[model samples]
Structures are given as C-alpha cells and as structure tokens.
Target: MAKIAGLAVGMSLALGAVATPAGAQTIADLQAQINALLAQLAALQGGSTTTTTACSFTRSLTMGASGADVTCLQQYLQGTGHFTFSGGATGYFGSITKSAVAAWQAANGVSPAVGYFGPVSQARYSAIAGTTGGTTTGGTTTGGITTPGVEGTITVTKNPSPASGVKLYEGDSMKTVLGIKLEAKTSDIKVERIRLDLDETGDTASQDSAFYNKAVQKIYIMDGSTVLASSDLNSSTVVEESNEISITLAGMSFIVPKNTIKVLTVAMDAKSSWDSTYNADSWTVGLATDGVRGVDGAGVNQYGPSAAGVFTNSFTTEDDILDSATLAISLNSSTPNTQQVICELGTDNDECDNLEVAKFDFKAEKDNITVTDFVLDIVRAGDTVATATTAYIYDGSTLVGSASVAGTTLALMTATFSDIDWVVPSNTTRTLSVRFDIDDAALAADTFVASTDADDTTAENSVGNTVTATG
Candidate 1:
C-alpha cells in the first residue's frame, strides 16, 4: 500500500509537465496554443484545479504603436532600470518610448538598437520572463514580432505620382519641387537617402529659355504629404563610386510601407545654381546607404527602370518651329522698298567713289542655334561686264570688324562666308553696314543684285540694284 501511494505521487508530478501536449516548450511559444492545450487538459480531469501561467504580451510594438502591450512594455522597461517614462507609461509607443526600448536593447546586446520588439527581442524576453522588470511585468508577452526597417524585399517603380515628369528651368528660383512618383511593390524598404546623378553636359535649349541653372547644391525630399528628409547636396556630397548628389533626410527614418504609393519630390536649392546639364535632360535618383539621412543604397536594385530609377521627360514642340533671321539693305536710314540697286556713276567715276552706296543689317528672332556658315548672293547686273565694284561691310556690334570682297558676275553670284563666329540670341537684333565704290570703271549701266536677308530659317528673299540706264 505504501509503494502504490509513492508511485501515484510520482505519476502526478510527471504529468505536471504534460499540461502542453504539443511539445515541451512553455507558454512562451504561443499564447493561444498554450491556452487551448491547458484548457483541454483541465477538462480531461473533471475540472481539476490546475493553474497555468498567463501571457504578458502577444503583439509587436513599433514607433507609432499604441496599446495595452506598449503600456506593459513601458512598465517592464521601467522596472528593469531601462526606462523612466516621464509621462508615466501611457501605453503609447512614441519617440520617447522608442528611445527607452533602444536603450534597453543596447543594454542587452541586441544587434541593432532599434526600438522594435522583434522575434529576437521577444525570445530574449522569454528567456528572462518573471524576473525584476522581466517579460511578465505588466501585460501578456508573446512572439511573432517583426523588426522595423526590415519588412521585406521592397521594389520601387517609376510612376511619377500626381502628374508627369518634372519640368525645371535654368536659373529658376529655389524650392522648386519635382513630384517623382514611386510605386513601392511589396514595401518594407527603409529609404533613408536619395542620391541624384546628373550628366555634366545635359541641357537641350528645348523651351527657348536660357539662363540655365543646373548646379543644385541642396534639396529636400518628401514622403507623401509629409516632409520626411532634407540634405545639403553639392560637390562635397558626391559619391565616389558613382559621382552623384546625395540628399539625406534630417533627424528621422523614412520607411516605405507595403503596397503604398510614395512620392519623392525633390525640392532643389534656390540659393545655389543648379547644374545646367539637368535641363531638358535625364538624371538619376538612387536609394539610400546604411547610414542615417539617405535611403539605403541596396534598395536601388529594388526599383524599376533600373539604373536607380532614373527620371526622364521629353519636351514636345507645337506648331512650325521657325527662326526668323533677317538681313536687309537700305540707303541711309530709309527702309528697303526696292529689291535692286546700281551705282549711278555712268560717266562720273568720282561720284561713285564718294557715294554712301548701301547699308546692311542682320538680326535674329530665335535662341541658341549654331550657324555653321552663311552666304550672301550677289550679282553684277546687266549685259555690261564690270568687275571693279568693290564693297566693304562694317559690323555695328564690332564682332565682324570690316570685311572687303571683290565683285561677282551676273550668273547668280554667290559670296560664301566661313568662320562667321556668332550665336543667335532670341528676339535680339544685330546689324551690319555696307559701303561700295565703282573704282574708276566706265560702264554703260550695271546693277548690283543681292539678297536682302538670308538666315537659318525661310527662303532667301532678294533686294538688289537694277539700273536700266545709268544716271
């Protein structure tokens, strides 16, 4: 009878650990799992009095998390000499609570001191539960906790949110924000910084607007409607590996959530001159690095259009793109009415020598187009052959100095000019004056035929001297 009684006591003690039939792990594995198992065991013994430990926490806590779990976490931290919530643990996991959690994590030698109560932290908590400020401090504690900034493999696609690609002008004032849409596929990427790479010679003069400002020295980045980050971007911040401008958010971490559309508008600097190469051209905005301020560099691969999700917008021109270049000849200050002129020195060569024969002027009505070369079509008019008609052209802009050329015959004379160094300014006018002499020639009647204005645009119009009979 004594042996049987001892055996029964041993059996009861062995069955104590059998409270959880699904393995030997304590209730720390899962709250629901432990509860169901414990409840089933209790019913089997006809409502026998058997008490099991309850869960203190069952959910994860993060930066913006606020609930009973956070309250319990705060209490535990305070008890463990890791935190002193000045607000007295209000159950809100705000910045203060995050700091305290990070402090505790660092104290306990966690890999990253982020205030995320993840699986590793929860496992550690389970190992030290029920102690002074341990896991069982004030609430139910459990696992299945995931770390922040490590959500998963994030993908970014080029989807310029709110509108099309950015359009910026040269010498534009600062604070110009470009709404670049980014579609985060399966989010979880903690985009810390955005670096921009621009080609040095990228302006296209597409919009007839000059004064290009392309040297962006600083910029601010926005995540949705919130201004998440900003950084001073300049020559100093160029990444040596890629030679790009890196802009990092100040004082906060910007994480891309799952299945969300995040717009990263790059508000460039107004004080500094932006790089002209970025005008009407394409550039790159890459993801962050491991450090604070910018997006994680590894995340660049997760974005589409590859090449770090480069941005580009093509400018389209409407209507006929015509440039008006006018070169007109006049006698003195009179506007040109006739198309032809001949030196009226029939028998008086002295009159031709001292006469102010003609005047020429050239003007441009367009912007920034290089003229490879220009020509002036002239003809020594009439059946009479005269080659002594010498002309000199003087530039009013002091650009062409003075050029002298001999006369050409009537078979459609062409005066080709090379090395004509000049740039066409939009809506700006430039002029040249011409003086000619008959040079002691005694011809019956000769006319000097020439085109009035020949430019990069339109057909060559004629304005020349026609002398039927010399006066």
Candidate 2:
C-alpha cells in the first residue's frame, strides 16, 4: 500500500509539470500581449508606437543654399525656437537662416557652431529624430515629416500706366506713371527690393544723369494710400549707365498674402527746373525683368517677372507728353492813340523821349513769365525810316527795355530789344508802354505808329517752357 501511494504522488507531480488542456501562456507570450495592449493605448492617445523619422540632410548647407532640404532644415530650426524671421521658413538659406542654424548647433552642443550645417549637425539631428515618436509624411512637420510644397512662388504683371496719355507738367508732383502687380501663390510673400527701368522716347530724350535727376526729383512707391518706399533721385540710387533705378526698402516691408495681388504705384515728383529743351521729351517707366526680389513664407527667394514672362515685364506710357506751363498774352484796351507830331525847323532831329507809341498787356496764365526780349514794328508817313532813332519800353513809368530802330526808307521799320529780364508774375497782368525817340529833320509833318508782333517776343517760365504770345 505504501508503494502504490508513492507512485500516485510521483504521477501527480509529473502531471503538474506537463501541459494542460487549458493551454496556459509562457513568459514570451505574456510579454507580447502586454506590448499589444500598450500599442492600442498609444493609438487611443493619438501617438505612434514606432519612433518617427526626422528630416535628414545629406550634404552640408550654408548661405544661398535652397531647396526642399533647406526648407525642412529651416522648419526644424523654427520648431526648436531657432529661426525667427518674420516670414517663417523660406527654402533659401540666407544670412538669417545661417544664424538660425548656428543657434541650433550651439543648443545641441555641436562644436564650432559657425552657421554652417555639416555632417556633424545632421548626425545629431538624426539621433534626436530617432528618439521622437512622430512619423514623417511629406516635407513638413505634422508629426515628424514636413509639409510638402511649403515654398511659395510669385507672379509679376505690369499694371496699366495711370498717366498713359495724360501730359505731365514739369512741376507736377507725385504723378503716377507706372504700376506693378505682384501676386503671391500658395503662401505669403515679402518683397525686399525692386528695380525699375526708365526709357525716354522723344526727339529731346536724353540719358544724361542731370537730365534724369531733374526730370525725376523724387521717386515714390505706394500701395493704395500707404507709401511703401521713396527716394530722391541721386547717383547712388539711380544708375545712369544701366538705366536702372533700384529701390531697397531696408527697414520697410511689403507683404502680399497667399493668393492675393498687390499693386504698387510708381510715382515721381516732376521737378520744376528741367531744361526747357526737354519740353517735348516723353518718358516711359516700367519694371525690370527679374527685378522683383522677395522671400516667400517658406523663406525661398523669388525673382520676377515670374508668371508674365519677359513680354509683360515693363509698361510704357504714351509718347509726346509735354513738360511745360501755359502763359497767355493780350493787348491792353488803353493802347496809345495814333497822333501827329510837329518838328522844329532849325534842328537836324527832334528827340521826343516820352511819346507813347504802343501799349500791350502780358498775362501769365499758369506760371510766372520772364519776358527777356521784344521787337516792335514802327510805321511812319512823310518821314524817313531813320526818323525813329531809338525805342523804349516802360512798365508803369519804370524803364524795362530800350531798342534802336533800323531802316532808311519811310515805309516801315523795326526796333529790337534783347537781353532784358522782366518778370511777369503768374495769374497777373502787366501792361507795358512803348515810346520812341523821333528825329524830325526838315521840319516835315510826320505821323508814327508802333505795334508789337506777338511772334517776335521772347519769354520763358520757371520750368523752361518757351512762352508763346498772342493778342
């Protein structure tokens, strides 16, 4: 009975060690179950169980390097509180981007953190990425991958000229001549600098620096009612050799949001002191090809005229725009009356200094007129043309000019006055009286009449426009 009980005990011990119909789990099986439960828990919490892959840079990056990789790097730096430019992550690696990379390297304890991104920085970045839990999809960092196509583009078009056919006066200020339209695609764009081309297209067109300076005293760029930038025409900003005008808005920024168009007006202050010879000159202002420089939201440098191509790169105004002021002249109603004069018989000539011969009024319409010279025609009867020796012009009893008569016969004669400076104020009329010195030889009865030819008068305004007279 003792042997049988010992056998039953041994059999019970062996059965306890063997597999049962319930199929109990081993240590490995229990561990796998726990992992599966943890994965499920991670999913519920909006996380991945596997480690995510971060952006990897194969080659070194420095300033001027641009592409998807650079954008990715910039985005990464921005996420890590390194890149902090206003426009966010642009694909181009500029000075600002370089500084950002240097900052990231210093934070990660990388040696010689000089703004340059090399293999050492990439290895460190990769190590950190491996420990992160997000997965990459495209190029942007949703989880670990960066969003694709982050770098935006721009389309440039020439806006219509506001003063296309309108005449621009020399003294006109803030006259809009050309317009440029920039359309941002996909993301916002910040324009940094712009270039313009000036083209003159008339008989009196000139490429002289002085001419350009006088023609365009001040240049202004405007967006609606706001002024974006401005510059006075100078050798530094306006280059005569290239016919290029560069306007850099260093501290100022012009931003065009995604899918929006910004129209920039190019206005100028037409100086009132250009050479009068350029009165018939016409000028056209336009945008230069590949002249617009700016950064997109992805920090990529964008140059234009991108979409419009070279055909629409510039906008031209109509030719034959006059740069002059208007002045009108008319004869005064109180003109000197025609009369006969008696001469002494004993003298070889009779000198009548204050004999008023003619009177005329000069009216300056738009600008102040400076009458420099005049020619008066004298008609006489019963006396030789030599009877009138000299003629004088008086402005309210003040002598303004004097001229000598020339001729031999009594038919007709002309007295010319040159090199005189007489200013006629704008919007005001000045009545001038003319008197003649008549030499009455032989004591003969003589009659004299004086008249001024409107075309023979010479005058100019402040803007160099020759004044045409009419009565």
Residue-wise C-alpha lDDT for candidate 1, range 204-280, written one tens digit per residue: 53321121123444556654445555555544544434433334444434544445555566555432333334334
* Per-residue alpha-carbon lDDT of candidate 2 for residues 255-358, written as tens digits (9 for 90 to 100): 67668897888777777756667655666666667878866544467889843564222222222233234456666788856565554432344556556777
Q: What are the models' TM-scores? A: 0.32, 0.39
C-alpha displacement of 105 in model 2, angstroms? 14
> Model 1 lDDT vs. the true structure?
0.43
Question: How far does residue 33 in candidate 1 sit from its true spot (Å)?
Answer: 11
Clash numbers, per candidate: 39, 16
Candidate 2 wrongly placed segments (more than 4 Å): 1-149, 161-163, 205-211, 240-251, 306-471
Q: Rate the local accuracy (lDDT) of all candidates.
A: 0.43, 0.63
Error of 1 at 370 (Å): 33
